[model samples]
Target chain A: MRRTSPISVYLSLLTALLCQLFPWVGQGVILRPDFMLVVILYWLLRSPNLCNVGTAWFAGLLVDLATGSLLGQHALTFSVTAFVALTYQRRLVLFNTWQLLAYVFALLMIERVLILLLKLFEGNENPGFMYFWPVITGLLLWQIMILLFGSLTRPKTN
Target chain B: MLKGVHQKLEPQQSPAFFVRGPSPFSRMVFFCALSVSIMAADARFNYLSQVRQGFIAALHPLEVLANAPSEWTRDTKKYFSEHNRLVQENYALKEQAFEQQIKLQRFNTIEAENTHLRTLLNGNIPIQPKAILGEISHMGRDPFTHTVVVNRGSQHNIKAGQAVVDSKGVIGQVTRVYPFTSEVTLITDKELSIPIQIERNQLRAIAFGEGNNTLDIPYLPTNVDIKVGDKLVTSGIDGVYPSGLAVAIVTKIQQNPESPFAKIVSTPVADVSNHLQLLLLALPDYKEDELSKVAPIETTATKKELSNKNTALIKNKAKANAPH
Candidate 1:
């Protein structure tokens, strides 16, 4: 197995965190992609040895801090997402692009549903249709991650 | 394809693959359980607030790094502004200052008289909360909750539970304080509730966020003397927000013959979306007697049988049954 340096993974995660922190105003904020989640998913798929469930859990904690949601809400959902993603990491090699996208779609949907349940239990009013907008935007961002950083599977050569 | 398959088969024979530690299934189950318990401990109890505060304090530098570009853009935009606009703005500001100076003279005398009157009445002098001025670092990342992170936090003596206000009115309350940043949950948030009085009739009611940038004053009768454009201000019975600060302006009132109560909606007067500078008022000293005072004040309105005393009992009963 080829070994990858840990520094690049961390740098990429930092960049993604900054992107998540970028100022968004008005309607654009509703459709803003979950940048940190997409990046953590990428690293979990690409280098499981370097970025594990613990790393994803830490990233979610940062988001919880940044978003100021309940302290452990995102951390709980994200760690579970990372664990789910890593479970299928090896089998992902046999899946095609459509299958990979579908898998990521499910992971993001789980995170949303988990957060929704938490919010409801905490007595929040239902957010309605707009709550799911991020999952669609995050899926679009996943494609960009694959295009720029290369896929999780073997590199293609002519 | 045949040659590539033969080459890839060699790694499968290696014994090192067997030593990849615990199966992913057990690890997944273990970690999932751990996270679930942590979530429960956080939500149902107060076990993790300190841990969260420390983590946020540590994350402050990264937040500033993220905020630098926006700060730079705001500064540069100021530097390259048109001279004509600047002159007009300067003139407007000078006129405003002169007008405000005249008002300040009258205000000083009125304030002194008001203090003297309160002393004679044996009323407790309202404590002036120390405020920390902070800029909105960003709107909340989660669209589900209405919150804003300010650049000032515990480092600036800002604490959770402090009231936040802009020039126009009450905006929100500080819910979380990190080292160099804090989070303000706006009055429009579902978890926030404010005690307010109708400026027209002085009918005091509690306003709760309906989650659409509007507040709901539930349980008031349909025949209540409230109209559109009525002003609502903090009643300050909660001892958190100071009394008589503007809160919202009535936008719509719906009376349903089928229901016992009128549906009133008001939009917050504070322009939380457009402004950066907000004052975080210090957390108040919680006094049990202040809560008890909520009921007595409700009786101040006189309808004979609907005397302020009965109104107070209604409030106390409502507070007992309320789902907050």
Candidate 2:
């Protein structure tokens, strides 16, 4: 099994929480990625034995409480993302970095779609294309986190 | 014996290493159910509000930690601002203070005279609302909604349901109050609405947020007497916002021959992007009863037409088409 202490995992999640809580106003709000989700998805994929679906659900609940949207909204999405990540966790050991990035991008897209569907159901007007900016930003954030924490797999040889 | 029982179960469960717990699908099912019920309890009821408040309160330290960098940057920027610019700003502010002092002197007498006239008419005296001055700590994390977290909340006696106004006009309402902060939902958000009157004619209407940065006024007839440049202000009917605060100005009006109602839009007077300081007008003492009373006033054909999401649109169109 890959080496990761539980304390470090929790600490990394806390760092993501702070980024998520950082006050973004005006156009910056549109660009703010799902920091907590990207981080949680990272840990979920890398160390599901330590940080499982329950942890992702709880992290998502914190986001819901923070955003002051419908209380369960983020919780639902985060749990589902965690599940998706877990389903592919075994295969992830063999997959290269590019394949991993693609997988993370797909996970973020699922989250955005979940939120959009929920918002539309709640009678909110459809926000236009700028809505998906967070997914792209999230992928970039995932890369940054990977660099900081070291990758799920070894860096490929030149 | 234990190893034999474990061996019998382990073979069925052992698909791969690290697969010790329940399947991901089962976990997903468990969590999704938990979340759905939580959502139902939250939206359909108020049981979780206190729970929510407690969790947010616990999160307050982390919020401050997150906010610290922005605070430092803002302060350093202020400290390093050019001397010439500071002088210019100070000079301009002094001039404005002098002008405002003159207005204040006149306003004091006008207010006294107005009170005397109101007493004579046996009208209820309107109390000047107490205001809590707050700085915008941060804009909301959600892009789909227009909300801001200010640095004042329940600990400071700031309550939910207060009317927040910036210097230019009404900005929004305080929807959530935490220990150290509150969320103000701007009037241009789709979920918020404010009752307004034409400053020139006092025609009452409700303004709805268009979700974009614009406000829509719906529900007036095709030939309502409103014109461009007409100012919309709070009508005071809702009791949440005090009457007569400037709201917006009619910006666009579309009256189609086929449609029964005219479409109107207005730009809010408040400039949220530029200004950070704002006033959270305390929710009036009598708001609950007043709101209940106003609920049943759909008495006329006009009231039926006023039910559109943007009744403010109609009011704006009328104001735009009217003679000033």
Candidate 3:
């Protein structure tokens, strides 16, 4: 594993925030990925020493502020997701490519479900089935992040 | 046993001693508690509004940077539009302006007559609200809520509760004001309710947002005098919206035998997504005017009392002068 700097994690998180802030209109909004969550998960998995639960929690707060929803809605979900990711950090080295993908998918689903529960509790409308559309897009974004930054698992040897 | 095995197996696998200050579970618990308190405080109090405003103000530059690409694309598209389209648009606008001018002429006489009639009835003059034109910076980031951010804000003299309207009709009301922008909650949001009167029969009722692109007018009798095509306009009773502004058109009416109230649904007239520009009407300070009206009534009562006293004195003087 390459030693990473703290600045790189923060810079990448800021770039993800910019992507999240992009104006998405009409039907496209439903498909908008949780860019910050995917990026934060990447750093948390890659360098837990530098990107910890506190980093995820702060990033979630920024998401909450940007979305202008209730305060701490995203923050709570993000920290919970970070905890799950960190708990499984030691076992990631043994995970194959498919297993890693499944792990990321579960994390994304956890974040989405947490948000849906929060929204429902806050008395928002059911938002229909389309509310889960972000999960699929977020999965795709996670794959892209892995492709760009390299995979978290070791290469298979014959 | 697994912990002993793991610790005994790999010393290098553990995180650096300096970097691992606290357990992830403890950090997660602390953050979760902190966020829950913040959520409780934010939902129950107004203390965080100032903090939210300052943070949003600081984020303005970043938002502008993010918006640049879309703005550039729109500008390029506008610049590349064909000349014929511009001419056609200009022609249509000219025709619209001409028709509006003709209507204004009739409106002037009607307004004068309305003033004269109101004065005869000792009614207070209606205040015409001043308006500021603003462009929608973006739709609300949260899709679950129906809100839009307008470029006008506290810096632009925008106050919460101002009426927002498009050319077609009332759009919504300003709910929050930041430094360089304000949040306008649309008429379709669950929290907003408007006082409306049917245009056909002048039946007054309050319509609430159902949060599903329709307004619900409940509490009306199941056999109320309303139809599917009836138009709803501002009743002006709440003093927020002026009378006769178009609000919505009745779309569905469901009368349930089991329930006492009718399920009347209406769609707002303003196409919130169709327009980029909207008008924010300034809030009317009618309370001060109402107080002034009360002051005049007191003065008039005192003057009447003085006249009654003078009349009694004159009557006594006449009796003295008549040598009775």
- Share of native interface contacts recovered by each model: 0.59, 0.85, 0.82
Where model 2 places Cα greater than 4 Å from the true spot, the runs are A154-158, B1-19, B288-324
User: Per-residue error at B101 for model 2, in Å?
Assistant: 2.3
lDDT of 1 by residue, B1-324 (tens): 999999989667547745556655566566667767877776656477678778766766777787789889999998999999999999999999999999999998998898899999999776777777888988887777788888897778775666799999999877766777777888898767888998877889999887788999999999888999999999887667888899999999998989999999999999987878998887555522332333211111211323355578889999999998
Q: What class would a CAPRI assessor give candidate 1's docking?
A: medium
Candidate 2: CAPRI quality band: high
Better of 1 and 3 by TM-score: 3
- Clashing residue pairs in candidate 3 (N, C-alpha, C atoms within 3 angstroms): none
lDDT of 3 by residue, B155-246 (tens): 99887777899898999888778899999989889878888999999989988898879999999998899999899999976666778899
| Model 1: per-residue Cα lDDT at residue A34 | 77
What DockQ results for candidate 3? Answer: 0.79
Which candidate has the highest lDDT of all?
3
TM-score of chain B of each: 0.81, 0.84, 0.82
**Tens-digit lDDT string for candidate 3 (A37-90):** 999999999989888999999999999989988889899999999999999997
TM-score of each: 0.84, 0.88, 0.88
1 against 2, candidate with superior TM-score: 2
